[model samples]
Target: MYAAFRDTVSMREVFDSCSGVTDVVSWNTVLGGYVKCGDIGNARMMFEEMPQRNGVSWSAMVGAYAGSGELDVAREMLDEMPAVGRNIVTWNSMITGFARHGLLPLARKMFDEMPVRNLVSWNTMIRGYAVNGEMDGARKLFDVMPEKDVISWTCMISGYAQAGRYTETLELFREMQSESSARPNEVTMVSVLSACAHLTALEEGRWAHTYIDKHKMVLDNDFNLGAALVDMYAKCGKTDMAVKIFHSLDQKNVSAWNALITGLAVNGDVQDCIDVFEQMKRSGEKPNDVTFVGVLTACAHSGLVDEGRRCFQSMSSSNCGVQPEAKHYGCMVDMLGRAGLLEEAEELIRSMPMAPDVMILGALLGACRMHKRFDVAERVQSEIIGLNTRQAGCHVLISDVYAAAGKWGEALDARRVLQKCTIRKLPGSSSSMR
Candidate 1:
């Protein structure tokens, strides 16, 4: 739209043409256009110059700032508005702005201060809590709401999805249908499908498919929901079903492609994962960082070291700007380490642009355990444990190394510290696993 007028007409010229229109609707449309075109300066200018500002205008400007990732400015706009006759739209905009931006405390404050709370206001706060992993807060809000709708139910389902709480999502989704004005919508099904996918609840996922088909809601613009369905199936380790869905998708996006590729990778179907990547590129779907990670992880699991190395390198200087962070480095190192190429993995760590973190060291430690390299294991263990937010499980790793090498006294010494300090092992650590 901007391209149509950029050469002959200035934005101001086009915007001013609406001046004689004389309605909040016209002004709001112009404001939204400015935001969409990324002209924040002019948007703010037109907003401040408006003679009559309605709740829609205030909400539009607030949304513009929030949409552009300017939470502070949005909050300021909210604060400057007169507290009289402020409609639900204004309050909901402010709540949603802060919530989307991950400003939970501020969003909470806004919700508490709202004089006449409505469904949107409650829904926004609930969505915020869900996004932030404050499920209890969301639940608390859900239990206390004077009114609820399908969106509110969907919000709860999505919160459960965020926590990988598949069962809870299904439970609440059922309850939503049984009670309230909340009939499940496309968004609600998407949440349920995602949970189904994540948990490999194929039966459940299939059930959602039936529901969407029954409702005739599987239109092409619903691609966001479709992408999620593909992701869920893939992550549930169901590559064949995932591929079937991808084939059915009319306009397959990068996300849809990534989902299928990731599913193959996660399931140790390396050749198919590579095939999908090549296919996506040929079809002009640009791979994002996550796409690369999924492919690399596939290569790692299947011992395609060369492909893994190439993928990691490609993510960096190859125009992706992903620049191989610690997780990528860790994945590559783990691949090599699992292959018993400990020295090569160590060399990769040394050559890393960023310092290796606990994950990297832990990978090396696992490799040491595989090949019984106690001496190297001790050093790697210490390095990993030091990086722990708490004590981690380093002491146990060191003790295990000593035991592996038959150094009884040192092993005993390590255990003594555990008895003395009463350190509980971190759940995901090797020390706890062993």
Candidate 2:
């Protein structure tokens, strides 16, 4: 019954229908079912009505509250639990809950207070620190851990990758490989392949791919791994290889299609990007915001203004199943701006629900410079200034626009602003020096 509907109401009727067979264990069974489904209201009511409670009962309630992000309530329950009932599993559940919610400080405090430390306890705390970008603390704990598992290694590797420390990510993977007991799993390989992609280390990527093939690692249901492989190959200027792997994928989820579409866009295969998008739509795959970002980017790069406009409009038309995000708007602005459609671009900016970001303004300013439109140039410059953006490139672009329009005084004023910002540019070496 719990397996099918998780129907607590029916389960209660069955329990009540039984002939004087109700006990703490039976009560706990019902409570556990409620806890499992995250029905906090029912669980709370059951807890209050129970004639007697034990460690499991108390622990179930604590776990449920913690899982629901009510960490303070979970802590209160732990405090109320009888001394005999508070065991390692109960403590671990609380810590796991706090960690899962990114409440690192609370999790760490609990970790310090727990009488017994298990592998799960250590892993949970380390993962908490890693997830919250406290890699230093994670590393400190990771170094002192008595026993290490694949999860410990993977957590650190994933943390480093997420922080853009790609070199460290691969280096850690190498260390994981040298250890006899631990080997890279599907999760580990994803981070490692991502690092390879960032560095464009094709040789290393190939080696990783070979490792997967040699191990006969089944990637049938693991589209993330497959997508990572496609992304890595495409980023390394090997779109042909990416296409082959994409075709070989048995199950192409939205993410898989997104990877191929984005990869094609990055590789300058604009027509292929459009073709893949059309194919994805025809196959009943829903295009996400990221998918359209790639499609709009293709149109932008290929100067397909009409196509870009059509794609942008479809985002909110109930058919696309996506809402235009800031990045999608950025792509459209860049597209229209590049095609000398400044009025259309400005109108689009005004229509944005959210204020235009630096990228959108920059695209418009660039178009202003290209077309030598001082009127629009001054308006965009004012907006950029209103933003108080400290970006040196913005000032330089504004200066260039002013100078191109023979506004020497304004150009000098813009250069002064750039100087006031104190942004340093590296000196370029002469060809003779090289």
Give candidate 2's error at residue 145 in angstroms: 1.3
- How well is each residue in 1-434 modelled by candidate 1, as lDDT tens digits? 33345422264577666547567666666676677677888778878877788877777777778777798888788888777636778778778878887889888998899888878889889999999899988999999988888778888998898788888998888787677665688778888888787677888787887888888886345546677777777877777777888888888887788878888888888999999998887897778878888887888788888888788777755456576778788888888887788888888888988878766776777677667777777667566645643454556766776787888887888777677777777576557322
TM-scores across all candidates? Answer: 0.82, 0.93
Q: Best-fitting candidate, measured by lDDT?
A: 2
Looking at model 1, the pairs that clash are 197-232
How badly does each model clash, as a count of residue pairs?
Answer: 1, 0
Q: Which ten residues in a row have the lowest lDDT in candidate 1?
A: 1-10
**lDDT tens per residue, model 2, 113-212:** 9999989889888888888888889989988999999999999999888878898888888887887377778888888889999999999999999998
What is the clash count of model 2? 0
Model 2 segments beyond 4 Å from truth?
1-5, 419-434
Q: lDDT of each prediction vs. the true structure?
A: 0.78, 0.86
